[model samples]
Target chain A: MPKQAPVPDELSKPFWDACNERRLVVQNCTACNRMQYPPEQTCSECGSEHNLEWREVSGRGKVNGYCVMHDSRIRLLQADQPFNIVVIELEEDPAIKFLSHLPGTPVDQVPVGASVLVDFQEVGPGQLIHEWRVVG
Target chain B: MAPTGWFPTTRNRSQEGLGVWEHRGKVAVVGIGNSPTARRWDETADTSVGAWAISAAQKALDEAGISRDEVDGVVTCPQGMGSPWAPNPIPEDFAKAYEPTDNPDDGLTGVSADWIVKNMGLKNVKATYHTPACISPALCAGAQVVGDGEASTVLVIRGTGNFSGRYGQYGAAAGDTASGPGQWTNPWGWQLIPQIAYGFDQYCRKYGSSHDRMAPFVLNQRKNGALFPEGYYYQHRPDDLKISVEEYLSARWICKPMNIYDCDMPIHTAGAFLLTTAERAVNMKQKPVYVLNHVSQRAKVRSSVETLDETEAFTDSIARKVYEGSGLTASELDICNPYDGFTLFTQYFLEGLQWHGVQRGEAHDFYAGDISVKGPHPFSSSGGNNGNGRTRWWNQLDCIQQLRGTAGERQVTLKAETALAGAFTPNMSDWMVYGTSPD
Candidate 1:
């Protein structure tokens, strides 16, 4: 329920911006040609501090794994029933370590290798985060 | 905000087997002590969990034939994240913080195994902290302390309430999206546990196992729980330990198969292991217990974290590494206190070592019987996590009493050549196989 952007630092600002714009953006290091999310200034792979830019991915990925959570706060946000969260692998993206919320209609039905795209929800104003739902 | 996935990785397990002890280390465990396990201590009491820990520590020191002042290093595990609904949050023992100050010579701190090495301020005095659902890893920390040599003698402490009650209850709101008493709520990352479970369930399904069959495994675990006096659920031995798609938890199932009993209880008790190296143990006035061996494993891949990796299995996950370190195999073990936070956890090991070639199929008739000294493989004389309390105290105490031959009526006649202990499920367990020669 944070009113202001909880985005604290310069390095992580892009992720928050993408959330506000409803467009999921990732950082791609031009030097190593690698794509990363949770936008780090430096590349974890090859450790190059080279040209990094905000690049928009297809916003689609495969469910590498998924989890069902029953959080007290989650109840306040949505239904008191089971909801799915997942780790997804972006298609043909470099620095491919992608982890985020999987927002399918039902958690039980989230399948491995299930094709998914990012879906955003507004819990608080000026704040929208991406959740994934199964597509094609 | 969900904490960023980046966590400080555990101290490298890769450095093990390559440490100095790989050659010259000759450490033998000398003493161990634990508080009696009980259900629900009144937090509003004069006797605090801190007091319980000190009492156990005193008994451990007494058993080790060492003086508290003689200790030069210490090891401690952080108290469990106590209940959010509890009146007093984080029932910390200022006493634990004070133990180092009280003793002065042997104080230690840091996260898991790293503490022993850093604070005991010795090149060799090893120390570490752990949270492996229960006490087995804490016990393993005690062994690592002795083996790594942060202090000539190391004291390992595990405890929580009676002195502090509210801190010992599990948050009911977890898994349950509702605000009901039976609903699930986790202020902590506990909700992540369900996700982990789902990940594991997916693994099981991929392997063609169904939830109906998994229920029997869980029910068998509940039965084992029926034997313990202090276990969270002491009376009911559910006839079936099965996993279901319907999700039988307070909240939408926190992952399939893992139920309330399958989880370690929020506890108000203390357990400690006081260890002295063989050389120092001899000089001390106390007759010391010996540690035969210790083993540990970190995940090789970003493997499933919520449940046992169905493919690699818990036993194959680290048992052989520990078996080699402890110099034991299924054949040589006399007692086993495998980390049984959940049922199939021990069975996972049972399946891997093929405890008598036990296999993993949908309907493998798996029931744990007391393998006595008189019988083939005398295992978990205290009912593993099931029969014994899941609190880590049993893990250490089981090995201690076995080595000391003080298991009372439950004592096995044959002197145990090896007693294996671990915290193998859902985390990197510090597993060790202890040996005994009652001379």
Candidate 2:
């Protein structure tokens, strides 16, 4: 089964567009100079709706926190049993981390503060999502 | 002076007490009631969401000594799942017994405020419905309507039957232009458990907290739940009550750094609270629990904002306003009940309330003290949402009970004194302080 895909709208179209191109982009509030995630209509930091822009990010972050799903009631997720769902804190902004499944990593070896790089995988037709891999 | 109809910005001493805050002593919780909480597998026709709410409302009204005719305002905090007619697609099995009436379009969703009012035969009542049920907001709404002279009595009702269906049945993270599970989190395989596990993970990294340090707080809740006769775990699953660190550690992990016991028990339950003017409360049948302060507001980041470090200083605003508005300190509170849907929230809110002195980005021994029913500061004397059934507004119920000096075996030492209870949703935090009388 294909991986879970997000339903994107106009406010989030740009971020998802960047993902299809294998680029990590986030919403930058021109007013507050604060970067945010999961794209929004306005800057959550400054409430600026007019000056929002989609900007590419380094896509490198440290492990903020994570969990290992030993079992899932959802059938589609069961194929990737015992996977690690990591919340990565982007290097550009500690507060702007995103959620992604970290495949092929030993659960015990998962580092809480280790650096990681973002990569994309096709979840469905013409659909690409950002994922994380540990970096030395 | 407190605002007669609306609260002013500055603090003022009023007839109620210091810093009456607009609603202080203006609205009183004259009655509290709960339907027996049971597992979904144990659900009966009587336990349907509507039935549970009606039963609870009847009891609360009975306790208040107010007839249905007296209720002019009804505030409904419906479950997260959609109404029976157009039910949520995810929890497909839930409310299957609910058959759409001949007039499904009449807007009488069984859980809606209008339906509740009609069912109770309340006359000339203004009904307000709060979508995506979270009980705290309803309590705050009820207090506002009555305190502002909009109505004399308001009935706040909330119930959840998710246990019979499933969690995440309604999806996570709400947004506009996008319906059904919002972006980032769901697409990335993140749900409630993983999301919270991440927050606690960050807490551990910054503060140096480990499993050992966090277990005591959860254990304190278990102990408190054990003391309550009606607690689901203690009563039905008696053997599960005496959980230890060893047992907790050995349990299978649903999410990293969190075990099975770290989460809340999912059970179907309904609760009702009756709000009336303080003067009227004095004439009621039950002990009056005055609404000293009701503060509900957002923190720095909206809950919808998907971020890695969401927990950092998120509850700061809630803490600041609750302390300042209520004119009470952590030490002054005889009982404290924070949202404990997840044990992590209990710890975070405890620290936010200054019950513990843990600094940000640093960890301390969370289990160092006895934070039990007999502890220095009694927290969740009714076992909270963790040990108790997730009755949605159990915090308020427990707070009212403590302040009324009727908590029975789980009674707090400072009964009939100041008690603080908090409610937390994804992006917002609200707190309510209750006192036995006008201070």
Candidate 3:
């Protein structure tokens, strides 16, 4: 297997910087004013060669959907556990979408379209990254 | 809500096959099939979901027709549960689970193969695509259609490895972020929370409760699911599904109005089906299940999920559309599958059919044994995703088995019947109904 390739260059640099700081950032194109993941160099909404800036979000959102993914590689890479995949419909000027796991909560107990706020979980030194979690 | 007819006999009956058959005017899902359930090691990482799905496509094709090249276009969706929790969330009852060595990919490979066949522009070629978590792969197989974008022949099949505790799932981040799988999954950021719990959290909040209350609902779901071998909670019960407010802190925050139990389970697998237009089916091998009527539509607003104005999250527009298209009322069916992953969904599904004047209340009046192909109405006798099995493993497999009359211990004695199956979600909802025989 090709060594699980690193997050490509076009999508790198900034992504690394945010994770090291425990801040969650999404790349929004100024030209198209659309948010993208996998760090698109070209705007997906409009064919514009736009530059992306790491803008922070309120991290407040609702659970549009969810599931107990009985299988995964990412979490297994860290801990041998079955993590939940929570699909977040963000609440921003133009809401963004995200998928991630929760911290310290039993996802099965959660419901659809629930309100939540952002939180962080430390994984490593300067390696702390933002993870979604249910807020009270 | 009285049944229009106790039983009607369809004039179409073909006795070409060797196996014992029944003709009761109602259409029965006479055929059931699958692709080989791949072990973790049998397939490769690059093995496309289409590859896994096509295996079963061939089997369903063999059942539908002898020619392998008669298929058409393809349609399918990934219907397995959407993981919405921690980096790695195990089955509620992980202690009693078996793990697979490998996992399967998502999408309609089964339908893709059908496209390979149908796009050949074969006459009588048609395609359909469907998936509701466990039965996703199977739905892919059913969507085969040829030229003109519409063929008389269509096939639907889905397969699932079913979650057997073989693998764990994690969503590092569906957002544009710098988080690695590990760093992304860590509870370091809130922006990346899975949306599942948020749905429930929102629901509870709006209802003036906490997400913790959803446990009883799920526990009950597990209780009902115990009857099926393929159920994710085969060994779990309501008592074990406990979660406190503090203990339930998992996701960063996804969606609202629903929660974890409110969501579906993500598993591996495939299923397939061979569908022929009623006209073409009449000329084919044996008496095929006829599509007397169907109504499929998606609510842009998820009328079902609305807080209260609607009787249910599911609305009646589509079910009514089906009734009008089929020129039949809910009083016309002998069986039903309400796309039940949870009771709430099922309740709304029932209401949708009821809007078409289906006396769902009366259907439950008959005894389980009395409610058969020969008796009143049998709803999900092979067990629904919630009743017998779920998407992770047995959703498609069980539906096929029941419709085909191949369900081992839970088989109902019905010669003629019409069955309904559906998949409902916030984004899209699909509803389909087929008659085993046209009386």
Index of the highest-TM-score prediction = 2
TM-score of each: 0.70, 0.86, 0.49
Candidate 1 is scored at a TM of 0.70
- Candidate 3 chain A: minimum summed lDDT over ten consecutive residues — where? A1-10
Taking the tens digit of each residue's C-alpha lDDT, what string does model 1 give over B58-173? 77778767665666555566434353323344224433443332222111111222323332332433233444444555545555555565556777766644223333334333
Fnat of each candidate: 0.12, 0.38, 0.06
Superposition-based RMSD of candidate 2 using all C-alpha atoms, in angstroms: 5.6
TM-score of 3: 0.49
Ranking by DockQ: 2, 1, 3
Evaluated against the true structure, the overall lDDT of model 1 is 0.50
Superior by TM-score: candidate 1 or candidate 2: 2
Model 2 residue runs over 4 Å out of place are A29-34, A71-75, B1-20, B41-44, B80-110, B127-131, B163-165, B169-181, B300-312, B356-366, B414-416
Per-model DockQ = 0.19, 0.39, 0.07
Give the best candidate by lDDT. 2
lDDT per residue as tens, model 2, A1-136: 2466666676767777888999998888787888877667778777879988888888898876677766454445656766777767789888776766766567656787888999888776687778888888
Highest-scoring model, DockQ: 2
lDDT of 2 at B103: 33
